[model samples]
Target: MPITLADKLVVAISSRALFDFEEENRLFERSDAATYLQLQRERLEVPAQRGIAFSLVQKLLAFNTPQMQRVEVVILSRNDPVSGLRVFHSAEAAGIALQRGVFTQGRPPFGYLRPLGAHLFLSANADDVTEALGLGYPAAHVYTDSVQASLAHPNELRIAFDGDAVLFSDEAERIYQAEGLEAFQRHETDRHGQPLPDGPFKPLLAALHRLQQIADAVPGMRIRTALVTARSAPAHKRAIQTLMSWDIAVDEAMFLGGLSKGPFLKEFEPDFFFDDQTGHVHNAAQHVPAGHVRSGFASAMVETTATIRKHQDQG
Candidate 1:
């Protein structure tokens, strides 16, 4: 029989996203790969600090039991094999049971997501995330400097997602951006009964939904999700209608209109939040762990590609 990740909720993460490698990353930025590799080798025995996504990964991994394994986390990193030893060591020190990994030695690692059947791809590399998103995977650029997740929801995996772009197609967002608020609202109002097109994160949300159903039989295990968006009233109706059409239900929904999302996300205290807009993601990161979805109407793929090329040159 062949081994497969088909039945599990697989999450592929980068070493930097899963651990606090910012200091080493800074060294990489200032020096050469050899210098960085030496530093990692020197610190091989020390466990890296927990990163912004650490808590989320910890809770998600807890869904697995000796009798049933519901989740699989794979390290999909740009670090060389030597540096990867530290990533695995850190996971063990943190009590996170990660058994699979792919080390690409500074190359973009998104290509492996297809074979992993990853429901989510979280990384510190914007170029890799952008490439994964381009390939139709749910990928996010982890805000490394973002505040860590709250400890309040120890037994629950709480995730929040923006409506447009993150959860649904950027179709209406493009309209909103090009035509302005009044026109966007009117268009949504007229099409309130129609379901919006699926977005990149939809598959991840669906996978989470299935995981939630499976968690029902496990005591003290829970998964809560939210729809946090800037749309309100007329525009909000279509968002809800779309979720209904897809048969997915979120535990909470915040239609913030045009207000800043930071304070509201602080109150929600999600393990993580995803938004396509850099501004929204930056704001949310001030309060909760947040990632920038590099796909949608506001995608900065060109900028990300340039960044990737620059890094490759540095590597």
Candidate 2:
């Protein structure tokens, strides 16, 4: 029988997203691929430092046990196979059990996300992330320089997500962007009973919810999710109703009503926080590990559209 990832919560991560390769990356940018490959080869025995997404990956991997493997983390990198040696070595040194990988030698690796059945794709390359999101996968551009994960919750994997353009479609956000707060509030209030459409991250959130259920049976394993949004009061009702309609619930919800999300996220101390807006992502990155979900509204939508057109042209 062939092995399958049908029942697993699979995450496809790039080498830069998983470990600290900023220096090597800078070299690759400054010099050439051959020079970068040589640098990686010289440092083959040196384990790479943990990057922004390391803690999240490490915690998720903890869900796996000898009895039953509930999670799978694969290296979906653009580095050549030769450079991949350092990546695998680093994972081993860090005690992360990563057994599968794809080294595309500078080629876009998002194509393999389908074969991997990945629930999430984290990479430092914004173009690749945008393309993956355009393809309807839950993908994010990991902020490599973002603050590291907190040690406060060792046994728990805590994740936080923004509401509009993230867990739900950017429908309300488009309204707010175009018609101002009063109109947006009125719209939400009127449609409080109707569920908002699913966002790109909705699939990833659903996958995490399933993982939470599975963790309930595994001793000492836990997953907690939070909806940290700018929606407040009347607008919050629809967001909650939408999750309820989908039969999913977040462990916590924060409707900040346009308050700066950074301080609040600092208090929550999530392993990772994801938002669609660059401003929110950068602000949250100052306090905790954060990623930008490049989908829905403004620039994200623009990028997604361009990627779709690019693919269509290729096809």
- Candidate 1 displacement at residue 306 in angstroms: 10
| lDDT score at residue 248, model 1, on the 0-100 scale | 92
* Candidate 2 C-alpha lDDT tens digits along 1-315: 899999999999999999999999999999998899999999999999999999999999999889989999999999999889999999999999999999999899999999899999999999999899988899999999899999999999999999998989999999998999999999999999999999989999999898887797678979989999999998999999999999999999999998999999999999999999888999999999999998888555566678899999999
- Candidate 1 lDDT over residue span 34-64, tens digit each: 9999999999989999999998899899899
Clash count, one per candidate? 0, 0
| Candidate 1 stretches greater than 4 Å from native | 300-315
| Residue 161 in model 2: lDDT | 98
Q: What's the true lDDT of residue 234 in model 2? A: 88
In model 1, what lDDT does residue 38 have? 100
